[model samples]
Target chain A: MECYSELTCSLFVDGELTGDAARHLRDHLVTCQRCRDLVHALRAESRVLTESLRELPEEAPSPEAFSHLGFSWVWGDLAMMAAVLALGSTLFIWIDHLEIPGALEWFNPFSLNGLTNLMFNLSYYFAHGGTAMLTEYVAVVGGLFLVLLLGGSVLLLGRRWRLPKNGLGLLIVLLTFSLPGFALERRHEEFVTIAANQTVDDTLLAIGNTVRVEGVVNGDLLAFGRSVEVSGTVKGDLVSFAKRTVVSGSVEGRIYNFSQSLDLDGQLGHSIYGFTQSLRVADRGHVGDGIVAAAGDVSLEGEVKRSVDMLLSGNADLSGSIGRDMTVTGRGLTLTNTARVGGNLTARVRQLKGVHIADGAIIAGKRDVQVRVRKSQFARSRFYFRQALSFASAMLVGWLGLVLVPGFFRETTQAVGSGWRSLGLGIGILAGVPVAIVVVAITLVGIPIALMLFAAYLTAIYLAKIWVGAFLGWILLRPTGATRYDWLLGLLLGLLILTIVGFIPYLGGLVRFGIVCLGLGAFAWQLYHASRPAMTA
Target chain B: MIVEVEEGVVVEATSSEPSPLGAVIRMEERAQLRVAIAHLPENYRLPLVLRYYSELSYDEIAQQLGLRRNHVAVLILRAKQELRRKLAHRSK
Candidate 1:
């Protein structure tokens, strides 16, 4: 209807309009010079955006973003102070728990009640229970402290002080630390009977978290996970469904790996089978059998012992050698200088990026490598890596600033301490409540409350160690006269002490454990203190 | 001989067969027949196919999946047929 609308319609056909409203607005563009000009401007803007989109960096969230989100130094400083106080308190608790301890058999997380009962019974019969109790208290408290410190250090540093990040990181670290226990616990809880003498069926074994097969399979082997690495040999066809599938071993059988990323580095005795978003074949490896792969990005660096049939959704780099024949269908295919092929390469549709063959590089067969220029996946990875590096650097800078500025450090530490105290107390109560319920179910009397109190005692010891470790890390980072008269040297010296002393054998462990306990204690105190106000008010 | 697959026949195909596609169709036809006889659920198909080719027997797979004997056989056949056709189309 309008001249501008016609231009806008043309722009939309040329891939300008992203939303339905933009498409609908094309009607108004035809009648107005302003709208026509707007369409032209939008077209120019689109081109600019597309060109620049490839250059945008993928980075971690910058430390400045965190600061902007409001992680004040006051919180951190309080955390540091509370941690210091808790460490001292934990030492006293540790000594007290050990000295008054009866039988230490109940100190483990597994069978607390029965062990405690045994300990009390043994205390009445023999004085040996006191020694055992002391040993148990020391071991349990000490071990838990290590877990907490390791978890917290990873949390504080890995998250760069975001509450959600810290919590998630800590959970993962703790879960990783408790993996062996968790695995056993899962097995115990889920299964009633174990099938003995049942050899893992190769096919049944195909579906697993991690499967490494060495023999030939009579059928297709489906493998998948965060990482599925096949380095051994496979007899039958291999098919994987995963994020990443790496094949470094020989596959006598055909291989089909469907993943986000796939790698083939060994000889495929049969036809190579693969469909990945990104595919790579190593230089030393050979696909004796023909290959079929579909990828967003395909990189061929090695020898294709046979024919290669690939449909690249994005861009492909063909550099290595192919024996019989090669055919690539993609947005763009680049032939590198070192690439070699014995057979003709034919593509029904080919997009060429840049082909650079060296003087010495030989194409024994026909020059059938076709080309059509189109945008591809490499452009995207470049953009992402740049952003990631930028964010990481920014966060690093923020952390360095927090450590360097004394006032800032004090404030942040204080906030962290207050948070830890509240969190610890809440966790302690939550942990105790379950045990109390179970005890009451069994005893049907006042025994449940007593049992809960006992559970709280154990949990407190563990949490205390975590807080103390963190506190020790901060306090130990004092300005020592390492470099003569240099302020920078003093800062470096503090960091050095914090890292080094906190990792040493006996002394570090004790100090770290103490800090952790203190943090836990502070958290418990805060929770109780907070809850009391609501009850009273 | 080129045998056209009826709407529902399952075929089994191995690399050694004259045509991988033909064998796959056979596997599919057999699987379809089994599924009807056994009256099994749809979800059991993939695991059953994977188990069939591997060292697992019908009984073992049935036990693992918490299913009946006939259902496993049905699932395995159906899965075999589906995979063969999907893979054939994908390879092209």
Candidate 2:
């Protein structure tokens, strides 16, 4: 037989090998000294790696190892919580003082989907203190938010590293951007119009019934209206939230469109980030970057310098020159003869022919098409929103973790250092814990303990992803000096990817499961190794 | 791109063995590993640190670094070889 490839052997060591290959490798292992030696060396190095890291400065390490950030880090966290409380308390009190009834009608059971409706009504039934159900729901969700915030605070406080400069500003920006506002913004109610010859320099945040931008805007053009039209040139970004938006203008930057129906005939210097009901790019349009669109009906007859990624519940027709990749997931997809792709064309449609490609179409790269289950627009939107929420929350948690126990965070991630051993332990813990909880609960005497343990376990599982995000962040950002901000950037970038990946159909769930397993595995693996279970042995 | 160039430099600098032996192998503290890692080229260094230090699987490392799985293995192997040579040279 052929000598096992190093990649294969490496995968084998990482426990990423499968049935026949693994068996074959094992058989070869008995006969191959070189392969066995390689394996031995890998295992030995991994052990030494774990041991070497054990000498890292812990939050409370011995004198010789390294110094801890005991006081300053803790004080920084306390100071942050102080600020959050000072602001939050005022907001909470103000909200409570307000006599606004039906403002939270969106949270009402009837307004929610069937499942959430049922859950909300149940809470309403159990609001034993005669308080309004809406008030109670708000309070409960509010309490959960606090728990998440305080839990993050407590986690950060446990660490021993000072917060980065401008942490407060970063925190506010993260919180505000991630949390979608349900509160009333009456911008869409007014009838605003920018005349044909007008020129606006700054970004326009307008809300109106019928708004039209016909003049040049040096800054970003943002409008929320029933019928929004942009026929002018926007030197900056073009952001529109409307029922029907028609763009015939030129945008120097990106186009962010959140609309019911969109029609574009523009010269865009950047990409188009759109979430729409029906989207069409006119034949004259040109996109400098790529297109990331989630819409119902999409037809592109434009030019894109890079890739085109679309998650659609409706039909799609493409007639564009994609410089790189083209990934389309939808009910139906058509690659018109004009669609000439420089790279791969990956489509997950309802049927093989749900994606129709004309004979004139030239795909220079691979053409892969897989049929997929289509979800309701409502379901997909909700999923996207929840993912955004989860990503935001993880940022909060990771930020806290990085600040609190920077060393511990670093070490926990390094636990991934143990390779297959950590993965196996992670798998065992993730799969075994619930079973253990059930077994303990069967005795009834261990009920409270089991429940508490279960709660902590769940929290640990949630934080595992955050920890993984942090690890990813640290790896990506090269530290010029120990004084840094890369971890935060890494976390945001990594979690953003994780959240986006979690939106894919069948593959999304599988990817998330792998991440969870890896994270949980890394956490457990780190913990076990961190304890110096068999030091110097 | 710059990182890839660094890895090229490190690969050329490294000697025969993929890992160091003798006294240089005594990396007692994580700081020692950092010092050793500093010798590696930019590209291969992150992959090596991620694998040996972070305990990240080859696939995870690849995903994080945006490299192919097989490429990640090669990078790791090259990285280890370079690190071994650098540490040995340093010790001498």
Instruction: Please identify model 2 stretches exceeding 4 Å from their true place.
Output: A1-189, A209-211, A225-227, A241-244, A320-325, A337-339, A342-344, A360-366, A370-537, B1-92
* Tens digits of per-residue lDDT for model 2, A1-537: 678776677667766688998999999989989998777666555555444544432212211121223343356447656766675566445433332123222222223342364466667778763445544454444333443343334344333123334655655664464232212122323566667787776666555667777887777766656778888887888777678888887788998887888887878899889999998888988888998999999988888889989999988888977889999888888889898898999988887767789999999999998886556754677767876787787888887877887756777765654557655555555655654453233221234445655896798788777766666666677555543267778778777777678769999898677667677777764553333211221
Best by DockQ: 2
lDDT string for model 1 (A447-469, tens) is 33345445766655543433333
For each candidate in turn, the interface RMSD (Å) is: 28.2, 12.0
Give the whole-model CA lDDT for all candidates, comma-separated.
Answer: 0.49, 0.65
Quote model 1's TM-score: 0.28
List where candidate 1 sits over 4 angstroms from the true fold.
A1-205, A214-219, A347-353, A369-537, B1-92
Q: Who wins the TM-score comparison?
A: 2
DockQ of structure 1: 0.01
